[model samples]
Target: MAQNTDGGNPFAEPGELDNPFQDPAVIQHRPSPQYATLDVYNPFETREPPSAYEPPAPAPLPPPSAPSQSSRKLSPTEPKNYGSYSSQASAAAATAELLKKQEELNRKAEELDRRERELQHAALGGKATRQNNWPPLPSFCPVQPCFFQDISMEIPQEFQKTVSTMYYLWMCSTLALLLNFLACLASFCVETNNGTGFGLSILWIILFTPCSFVCWYRPMYKAFRSDSSFNFFVFFFIFFAQDVLFVLQAIGIPGWGFSGWISALVVLRTNTAVAVIMLLVALLFTGIAVLGIVMLKRIHSLYRRTGASFQKAQQEFAAGVFSNPAVRTAAANAATGAAENAFRAP
Candidate 1:
């Protein structure tokens, strides 16, 4: 081998040289990481190496305030979207408020419509059907004459009992009148000619039967039915007169042949049994008279409570008179005739 001056031997096995990096003191005294706390280990202690290896600690970050201060300094230069955000929030609020108001208005409109429908229903007499048809046939059925049906509306539930009692009284009064006629017939059979008395009885039935229903009872029925002060007053006046006549007839006054008193007078001279019967019939007539007075008082009390006055009656009467088709036609004809006469005279 040739002699080399750079080092002793290049190929010889590496020898332990005095290198600074390889010194134990330099290795032991190597700089520790700035972020971690270094712990001293004892050689004598039995220690186990950690199963998982840990990485070296990284360099420490700067103080927290340093980044915050830098961000604060840069904030003024950045663009803000304040105007767009505020406008969007306000528009959303306004749209929500408008929707709420619209819903409220729709609810009010629906309520008004419902009220209008109810009012219209009430105006049509509170009946299920709009058409004022007789017998009130079903909506699906063809129109037919229901003559035997209860075509008229019933009295109000509150007043039905009271009205029914009044109707019963009217029936009693009619029955009493018919009984008087029978008594008259018996008296005539004993005293006068039977044919004449029988004819009179028939005539009385024919005349009074219809009048009983139409003149007095029907008027009173209508009074309670309509609850009209005018009709009530009219019925009271007319029925009071009729009841007075009934009383006179029952007393057997000479002109009052329809009374039980007349029958009793005719039979009292002859038959005691017939006389007793006739007297009872007379008592019935007196009872009817008393009942009429009582009913008149009751009806008057009801009328007074109605807040109706003579002025209202007068107005109603005038309206009824003027509204009459016959009266209106006659008045028109009279006016036309007067105009023609005036033209002819001139």
Candidate 2:
């Protein structure tokens, strides 16, 4: 190149000769090239050193091993296995419940069997062998019980309540009759004219008590027990007569054995205490009449349901009469005598 006009270092790098600040002194004062290194400022390392009393950190765990083919296959079916287990548990519970019901049915069947056996035993003369508990008499008494009455044992489940009601009605009638006797006695004490009533009251009690029991009550009992049409008819006839008697007794006609409403009113003027007693007796009689009517209707309804009729009663009566051993023996003797007489005449 031509001799430079400006004064400049001839041995300098090509671009440094144009820059005056690129001197060695300035370059030395300038920052050195910062090369990136592996070291870095860590915030966790800046924390205080671990205390000597603290437990040491656990070592890093090893990586998990690869799953085997069998385990991998079973993993996908885990939910299905759980579902099958729940279904089996429910099935077991249902089976247990069914077993419990079967046990209950078996227990009921056994109870029924026991009842049937007892009934069969009772039917085969067991009832006759049992001692009579009704008309409960003291052992020292000379008179023994005439009948054995056990509504629960003798009557069917359907007829038990009806029979019990009739029995209670009979007891009430007996008590009323006793009260009537007392009232009549009281009336006689207050007025001499009532002597006839007092006298007749005794006879009525003696006559009506046993007769009513035998004729109407016994027939009703037998009718319900044996389903006998003849007994039912007898009960109806006698009970109707009893109903009429109740009405007559409730009417309280003068000089009648009963201390009825009319008699009570008549005695009211004579003695108030006697009148009160008589009125009570009269009301009892009236109630008996009403109850009798109701009971009659109930019995008739039951009879209708039983399919009993006059023809059935007649048939039963005829059959009963013909079945008598005494009647059969008499008939045989008569026939034999007639045959002998005919042969002798020939």
Candidate 3:
């Protein structure tokens, strides 16, 4: 019995060899896949001291109790335990699936953000989201339809009088050129003491006349019709050119010569009265233009309500032109110059 005990174990107390079949009373235990041990304690347990205890005479061991069941070794028939391993593998697979879905969600969110930014940049309708903000344009325009269309294709408002004025100016310039040519013919046909005036008028026709067609009037037509920045710049340049030519004529009027400036003096020759008449016509044109701008203010509120640029709003209006009350009114007014009273016309 004494030899059967694990005497080397520090947790085994002395004199435990008598109960060789019983396990040692343990004080601590370790429950882990990597280790095996169990500990136990009993406060009520008492040990008899050697002096108080008497040794019992040894009884012959009953010929070992029938072979103990615990002595049998385990056989391969025992059920195999794969439950824990399979569960751990299933958990890992589920985590991988969850991560994949999370990544897919993140990618979709990024795509949405990209599209939103693009939409924000292209404020297609001259209308912006904010009251104070100018309509923001896309970096690049895809206006293929309007690329080569008529200059007046998309005007939201009318300036027919202004357009007509430009035409009249062009006609007058052409008539003046023809008159100068006839004057030359007349000087050659009849007896003129000094042909110098005819020659000077011819010079005026040559220098200042083509300008109305090629520079000033054409550019003005383009600017007003297109309402484009590039055309506006062209118009301004031509205006400055004409202004300079007129200024030089005003200064150099004394010398009657065939210079670009001298044709301007031809206006003075047409009679100071003709010059005054031209001035009044020009002033009337200016006043009508200013009045148009004032009217535009009332129209501006409608534009605010529409929240669209000229081209975009015009396209929409033309497509469903009269569906909106404001657009219907505008279209009617634009057809005739009398916008405020067009509906009341007899």
What tens digits encode model 3's per-residue C-alpha lDDT throughout 239-281? 5555454444333332343222333334545445433433443
**lDDT computed for candidate 3:** 0.48
TM-score of each: 0.52, 0.66, 0.28
Output the lDDT of residue 260, model 1: 58
lDDT of 2 by residue, 1-346 (tens): 6544576665556666654677787877554323223454355666455445656888999999998754666656455444567898998899999999998888667657656855886888886766777578999999887777767655666787898888888878888899999999999998998888899999999999888888999889888877899999999999999999999888888797899999999999988999999999999999999999999999899999999999999999999988999998999999999999999995
User: Model 1 misses residue 79 by how many Å?
Assistant: 84
Q: How far is 278's C-alpha from truth in model 1 (Å)?
A: 1.4
Residue range 1-346, candidate 1, lDDT tens digits:
6554656454544555434466687777665443223365456867565456578899898767645533454467676454678897998899999999998888667656655765786788775544444345787887753232111233444455556667778778768768877876766666664355546656766777657666766666666555665666677777788778767756765334554576567668787876787788888988887877787787677677868677776777788789999999999999999999999994
Q: lDDT (CA) for every model shown?
A: 0.67, 0.84, 0.48
* Candidate that would win on lDDT: 2
